[model samples]
Target: MSQSAAVSPSIDLPENKSGPHTSRLGLITVVATFGGLLFGYDTGVINGALEPMKLDLGLNPAKEGFVVSILIFGAALGALIGGNLADRYGRKHNIMLLALVFMVGTLGCCLAPNWQMLGLFRFILGLAVGGASTTVPIYLAEVSPFEKRGSLVTRNEVMIVSGQFAAFIINAILFSVWGEHEVIWRYMLAVAVLPAIALFVGMMSMPESPRWLASKGRKQEAFEVLSQIRSPERAAAEMEEINALSTNGDSRPTSSWKDLTTPWIRRLIIIGIGVGVFQQLTGINSIMYYGTQLLQQAGFTSQGAIVANTLFGLASVVGICIGLMVMNKLDRRVMLLGGFVLTTLFHLLVGLSAYFLPESAAKPYVVLSLVIAFVFFMQGTIGPLAWLLLSEIFPLHVRSYAMGVCVFMLWITNATVAFVFPPIVSQFGIAPTFFLFAALGVLALIFIGTMVPETRGKTLEEFEDEFKAEYS
Candidate 1:
């Protein structure tokens, strides 16, 4: 084929031809998605650990907010710089480095003598969390076969929630076993170190992303990486496509911020940021980060709340599993719209249950069920879709940078919500607080309907051309 012909919008290649290739791809996915697992455990551990940590450190509500939200602030910075690092160094290197940071931060939190020290360590951990959030999905997307891209990329999403569920279960076990110990929170933070070690050790044998290698003019290495994960025929065909796309000048290695100033790129960035911001505005993290507190306020005792919050974590894991099963089958835009609608309705119901339900013993259960439903819809739809779409929408050259920016904003929004939620609930009550989320959910619905594009069933290159043609 002519170079230009090979650079056409799409190319067909063989399907599922090599068992070894599929196993290698599966292994890579498992190793790389350790980042997602760490992201979940680190973030979710705080939900249950915070109460005991507060007691141990003598933290007031302000310090509690600071400790919870500081990591997110650091995450914003991490997401910003991580993309540049990945673009320059390579995805595998970036993730391995993040794993080390995770170990250091986890150890720091575990050993900290004061809340301030814990906050400092948590901020360090946030860097890894932010980097993983941006890099893992991109790595998965680039490495996955086009037909299985959605499900494979979203496997990271499943691991993420699975990590959270593990943390919740672990925290409950620890709290139940050592509830009297002031140091239980330290042990909770310590569990994360093992996975970090695994990620670092596992990634040593993993290949660099072929798309990334191709972008950097490393065609031979790119083909070698692809050959490990694709049938020989398919590998050669894709290498041709990657080479043609690289040489045609349609997608250049992003040199600096100047390259992303084009109108279409700007539009993609906006859409990415909107998707991320809306995902956070669903108040999902508020629940994830403060589920115990919310449960306590709703009427559960401290131990009871800790145990009940596991249910939320379980719902998250289950919901994302469902999302993965249908990830390739469903249209991205439709899933996003349906998720927002369902989550918004659940938000309203939760608020109403808290507002009008009398102080009977059943009120907490009612509110809990509604919140669980909200989590189910949000995780299955917005949770996976936000990261998947962010990974998919950007051009190869700017994928890291664009995803970093969007996730940076997403973390910022998450920080804002985390910092404010306690005060909002304390001042205005849970009803009003969730009602506010419901209001934002309405706005999110509008944004998705108007701005988000359908990305299902298209190769990254094809989607890029289609998006540019329509939006540029």
Candidate 2:
């Protein structure tokens, strides 16, 4: 993406005071983000479960990495097609299907007869995860008023982190109670099934995205859905805006994969892909998925590390909560650059502490603090903001499709990092691994500084116009 650098001008939208329907909007957000909860639990469970699983399945280092990273490969595929599925079916329907996949996949993994079966089941679970990563944010963004869009859509990220925290807590409790029980990992994996059921039942009552309805020319249906979420006047106003942006005009272009090849649209999609790739390469998910392993390498015992890993998850939850509260007040570019800088420093500190602390009793706790700081800065800034921008940056016609492509790249990058991480640490040690991440973080900071556009408070329509100017 060329950084031609258009100066951003914010558009002031009409004030939309909260109404009686605000509670209804909150309900929908909570229900939709159950996808995120399942996304979090399924992915985070392996961090704590990997050891017991290894003992039970006789997994070597290479096989263990495959088992852990295969789900991400499946997620990459899921994200690749998830957009077309959401548009072809409705977003709510696709999400409900994902919920069923979550239940079946969790049960399959919990009851797997061998490592092979377990890997298969985990990939199945990843399908749901990848789909949710794309669909929930778009659904939330479309239903939300522009003023509340960032917080509302980011609520999914919050749920994702909260789900991971819940996994850490459950894993710790199970490990403490069961001690060396071989099947303890099964319980951790199976707990995700409960939220899958919740997501399925909850989405049954949720409405489809009104913006999607308008895109399909079902204007009245879209209006009805909007009225349920927005005040009467604001609902009508939003309906007008959606209609104006819809495909009613003879000059309006069709949304398709082919449109992605257009010069202007291609640049926007490139930017979206950059956003996704940078978010993953920052190495945040490494901690989310492998915190216990990292801590043990730092000097803690396995059990102690599993218990202490909960702190990482807890800090993530807190950071996401803070991000949600202050998200509306910040510029996306500024916050992202600041986050990358902090994460780079934290990574360097973690590497240096491990290299120099030298077999001391205090080394583990000291390293843990640095990791915790990294998690806080990450989840608080780039983690939530990345998903927020991906959901908001694309035009209404191509929103879901573009987001699918972006997240597909995100999962692929995530999988690459996860797959290579164990081998890298094994060959280079924890200090050198972290030093590599720190260097990558520096490059990611440069990418954000030069390439990403500021999307704070901009309407989807306003962004649409900006993209159109490239073609005009």
Candidates in order, TM-scores: namely 0.97, 0.95
Name every residue pair that clashes in candidate 2: none
lDDT of 1 by residue, 221-340 (tens): 999999999999989988887776777676676646776788988988889999999999988999989999899899988888999999999999999999889888878888899999
Off by over 4 Å in 1: 1-9
lDDT of 2 by residue, 358-433 (tens): 7888888999999999999999999999999899878776777878888999999999888777678778888998
lDDT of each: 0.90, 0.85
TM-score of 1: 0.97
lDDT at 365 for candidate 2? 92
State how far residue 48 of model 2 sits from its true place (Å).
Answer: 1.0
List all candidate RMSDs to the true structure.
Answer: 3.1, 2.5
Q: lDDT: which candidate is best?
A: 1
Residue 206 in candidate 2 has what lDDT?
90
